[model samples]
Target: MRLLQQPWPLKLIWLVLLGEACAALLNREWIVGAVALTTFGLTLLPLYVGRVSGVHIPSGFLVAIAVFLMATLFLGEIRNFYERFWWWDIVLHIGSAVAFGLAGVVLMLILVRGERLTAAPITVAFFAFCFAVTVGVFWEIIEFTADQTLGTNTQRSGLMDTMWDLIVDCLGALVGAAAGWIYLQGEQGWVLTGTLREFVRRNGRLFSPR
Candidate 1:
């Protein structure tokens, strides 16, 4: 009978499990899954739900997960995984870095400018970059562990690959974070009112009456 007052207990558990499954599916990572589950369930859910009350999903968090997953899956540490050689490997890393950078920039723009919702856009972007850096570190650690424990059939030079990956990761994050900061510089937050007005005035053919 006492539990009836907090029916959220049941629903919360379900959300936790759901988030864990999503994290695993997205990153193919178990630890990330565990973190995702706890954060979404314990922190993200109740706070946002109470703040917005009646919303089902934390849509923005979902978007972040999606971006992270896509970047992780396709970017860098390819072919011998630890070896640095040839053009295609470099190309793959560059592509991954660009994709990740663009993803961060686009997400921040949408969150800060288009949606007008954020947890301090600059701070969020910074922390996101930091997280990306940490991820780069973890990638090397995982590789080393795999080499030692699971054998090095797919592994190669940890030092070179790790260093290059770190560099690429930082560069990507810096570029992306800078773009987001520029896009959201002031209080009005990336408004294009003047630009839009000028466009409409010149293109009277399109919006003349329709």
Candidate 2:
């Protein structure tokens, strides 16, 4: 049957699972369990939005953001504020941003193909960096607030760690975007067929609407 030919394997799987993982990790030390509740809310955000919007975001993108948010949150959960950050902090660091390129090239590939890299390289690159930097700042803000009000020492380990985390994340985003763009222009094409498009075109009979 044509229904068996739908998508959502690699991309969606990575997104959902990664997001869930980050959420779980951040909540690892929740005392009153409120943080866990908050993380659960975050991890399921896409599902909530998807339910309301009647549309699905690229799983990979969701995963990327989730993981990023989780990274920021995890960084926040340090003990002191002036200690030299350690190296083995992240047990499962995927280096996702710089690796996946803002979900740009690979994401686009998951949708379309044959698109050449643009001449204004800075265009995509800038946005990609902006996304990371912005998210980094946002994470910092969340940490500060958590520390100021809730006294989540674990969340705001300190200034040094927070700063370092932002820098690392920004680098990952910028670099990843470039890599994705480069790969796009190479041989492997973006994924389009057997995706949501085909799902809609075929009258929503693709994946059994789990």
Candidate 3:
């Protein structure tokens, strides 16, 4: 309810989900339809968690996620972009890893600021990297499961594909972690530090010591 009341970017995510659902249903792709709907529903959980925690999630963040879902689920899986464009999956995997890594850093900062934990800058960055890699592993597990159970070729080249994906994920995560470390050192990158500043400004309570 609250999510729907937000601005157009948030609403756009739902609209994309609905379109994906309709496309899947029309094509008789039950698995795709179910995953699309389920993922869309699951995306709301983050906003709910943020609101409960007194964090004002930015519209750009929601829109970024929406674009990711559109590319990954709708285009990659349903439209077979993975097969059509050889680099599509690779690009998405790298982007997802970086995004997750940045999110992990934000989460760590929130926790530390909330008096829940303390850590050195390097430690926090390392945690973010690990968090991204861990998510990547879980995603690969999902791909494996889907390939085995639903007879999908999400794994592509099987072991080789999984290995490469993990490697790329790790590399992307490292980049994010490095950027975060630099930011912590009072340096600025337009996207990373700018976004962090905006996030902190919007939810100062979460980024302030009690």
Candidate 4:
């Protein structure tokens, strides 16, 4: 309820959900409706967790995540962006890697604040990079399993496709990890980190022990 009062996520939430509903009703694609509802529920998980734990996540970040889901699930999976656009898969892989990398940094920061872990810039960056890449690899595995068992062509070009995806995921994670390292070190003139700092400020309690 409180989340819906926010501007960005609120608007997008209604738009996407409504769009999905319309598609489902008009096109008789019950799967689209189910996926849309499920996506919305999953999208709310972070905010729900943050609220319960006294954490504050920036609206922009949440919105960005929602948009990513929109692109990945609705546009890519439902609309067949992967088939219609040659570069769609590549773009999504890079975006997911970066998102996951940033998420790793956030989790590491929280752990450090909670005294559950020690913080070192390079080591943290490496962890973030590894975390993102590991997730990407797992996704590839899922694709493989789905293709083999469910007769889906998610792998597209077999080993070649998987390798290229992993490569892109690695590259994107590297960039995100570097950014996270620089941001934590308080390097000046960095825009993304600046936004992160602002996020921390707005949600200081989230980064500090209760």
Candidate 5:
């Protein structure tokens, strides 16, 4: 069936989360069960968004997001990977910044109604970089709030950790912006370009001139 042929990576992750939730519930670990169940629900977000907004995200993009969620929510937080691995936090921050930067480009394209030729590449890239940095700042704010209010040590080294995260966020955003700029200049062979092109192709009505 067509449904069976959909991306399996996300499905596998959902199944894992479901099983984890069930096991936690059986063991009477309410908090763990709730977290696992919540994560499983979150993995369905792409499908929900598509149904409501009619914006068909590529399966690959959905898989990427699902993997990120699994890493952060299921593995990083639940499995204590953040405490076990020193570099995990850094890698996640950079990866999230880059992902957000690319998302900014896509949002801008939607705002411009896909009139790529009308927008300056530099302007689009700048917006992408700013969007990514802004999201990173917000994330740091959340971490700080959690550490203060919830008594959680998410900030770890406090100011030092926050500063390093912001630094890497900017670096990642810069890379994303450069990639977007290159793609907008009509270059090919880049992964981001292919994804963007696929988005535009699938949502032709969104990009078509009014």
Candidate 6:
């Protein structure tokens, strides 16, 4: 009952992925099955990490990430959304970069012992932007490698696709960094600040001064 009441959206997404995995395996589509199963596991990662690290991750954040993964791994890759919709790849790249940028902010806070009061917002934002860009570069590399080895068309128009992805990634990272900057400026009322504030609140011992 408690599980049904909380994070039901995530649970529903997980179930759908699981069903896809099972159906794919039954149809002898090994690769599709593997991808669906992997996505299902990825959805569980946040809960697993939170449990292991004693962190309290917001359910909304978890659901958002799960939905993103389902869109990318299952719908985009498996359902040929990238081929059907010209904008699908671009949207996913932006979404991923923004997520990575926000994650980078959280990492910076952890590094600074959550001392946002003393830490420089610009420095944090810069790190987040860099971190997101770096991740985007790595993803492009992976796409290149997969196209070369697995004969996948993930890169689509090759150079042009990669360039556009990087450009959008930078744009998304900038947005995320700007949000982080506002969050660090004590704008607790901001929508994005809510999750970060909750994280800090739940892990006060980890963030509090020594």
- Candidate 5, overall lDDT? 0.85
Shift in Å, residue 139, candidate 6? 1.4
- Screening candidate 3 with a backbone cut-off below 3 angstroms (N, C-alpha, C), the clashing residue pairs are none
Could you tally the backbone clashes for each prediction?
Answer: 0, 15, 0, 0, 0, 0
Better of 5 and 6 by TM-score: 5
Ranking by TM-score: 5, 6, 4, 3, 2, 1
Better of 3 and 4 by TM-score: 4
Give each model a TM-score. 0.39, 0.48, 0.78, 0.85, 0.92, 0.88
lDDT tens per residue, model 1, 1-210:
122333454445445456556857687876656555544444334434534743222333333433333233322222132244444444444434533544554443334442435546576567546655555567667878888898863234567766776687677666555544554453333322222233234434433322
Please write out the lDDT profile of model 4 over residues 1-210, one tens digit for every residue: 386577665576757777786779788888888778777776787779878977677776777777777777877887888889999989888988987887787777877886756678887798889999999999999999999999999999999999999999998898778878999788968755765677778877767874
Task: Kindly list the per-residue Cα lDDT of model 5 for residues 87-123, writing each as its tens digit.
Answer: 8988888888888888888877778874545667898
| lDDT at position 103, candidate 1 | 50
Ranked by TM-score, the better of candidates 1 and 4 is: 4
* Model 2 per-residue lDDT tens digits across residues 66-185: 555454443334321123445534321226445434544333332333245433435555555565566667767887888889966644358776767776776677665665444434
Error of 3 at 120 (Å): 3.3
As a TM-score, model 4 comes out at 0.85
Report each candidate's C-alpha RMSD, comma-separated, in the order given.
13.9, 9.5, 3.3, 2.6, 2.1, 2.6
- Give the Å error, residue 61, model 4: 1.8
lDDT of each: 0.47, 0.48, 0.81, 0.81, 0.85, 0.85
Worst 10 residues of 1 by lDDT: 73-82
Quick one: best TM-score, which candidate? 5
